[model samples]
Target: MFHVLGALVFTLVGVRDATWTTDGMAAALLVAGSIGVAGNVAYGFDSVHVALGDTSLVDQAGAAVLIKPLGLFFPLTMLLCAVAVRHVAPRWAAVVIGLSALAFPVANIGNIPALGVAVGVATVVGFGALAMRPVRSPSPATPAASAAG
Candidate 1:
């Protein structure tokens, strides 16, 4: 249900952007939405395995590790946009990313709108701060350390 809605949102956004002059952001959104739809499809197919306890521990561990990062992708992408594109407004990018992050957890947990908005606002603020930070370069090691045997 939520997955379907997300897919629709992505598809619509992609279509909307196609008419504009924006480079690839809309395409990326469409792809992300498609991935979300696919993820939900895979999740649905796994129901039998989940019910029968037929899955492996390794698979479960890998899935658990993947989940957190999967959830973080939206926020991360917004941050990347802020850093990579000079024209994009960081605040708006952050808001969209935040909304996406908010939507997933809330939708997964069966809550909608409220949590979605909250997560969206919070994520935007957090990432916005991150966007403002200056890029730092790694320091060169001393010659003494470089010459060590």
Candidate 2:
């Protein structure tokens, strides 16, 4: 979830660096973030039951049919955002994202302590790096241009 937010920030920063305004990259990030957020929210409703291996929580009308697939969209969009911003983001940020993606399985699925630490570091550094980047505003027009106008 935080990873998805970090990706959004990275894209916004990249777009800002160019002109300090929204652009195509910003639009794409918004769309991706929307899909991811929606999926995550829907999945949250069934997460506890799913984690507990209790299928009874699901109603007979197949209300939970979209749970798994939607939940998967969160990570998929995060990855998509990472890839989309890689060329524009700092190299270190990109590297951190890559490490986090790789360590996700060991950290969350396998419950490996060592890999968990790696995932933690990658997440903290990646989000921190993106968050800490300074947004450079476009320079004001020169006096000559104003005078000419």
Per-model TM-score, in order, reads: 0.33, 0.52
Worst ten in a row by lDDT for model 1 = 136-145
Please report how far candidate 1 places residue 73 from its true position, in Å. 6.1
Clashing pairs in 2: none
Q: Clash number for every model?
A: 2, 0
lDDT of 2 by residue, 39-86 (tens): 556544445555687653234346566644554554544455555445
Per-residue CA lDDT of model 1 for 20-117, tens digit only, reads 21335545654554554444434444444566777722267755445443444433343333332322234455355545554655554464767656
lDDT for model 2 comes to: 0.53
Query: Which residues of candidate 2, in runs, are more than 4 Å off?
Result: 1-28, 48-61, 102-120, 135-149
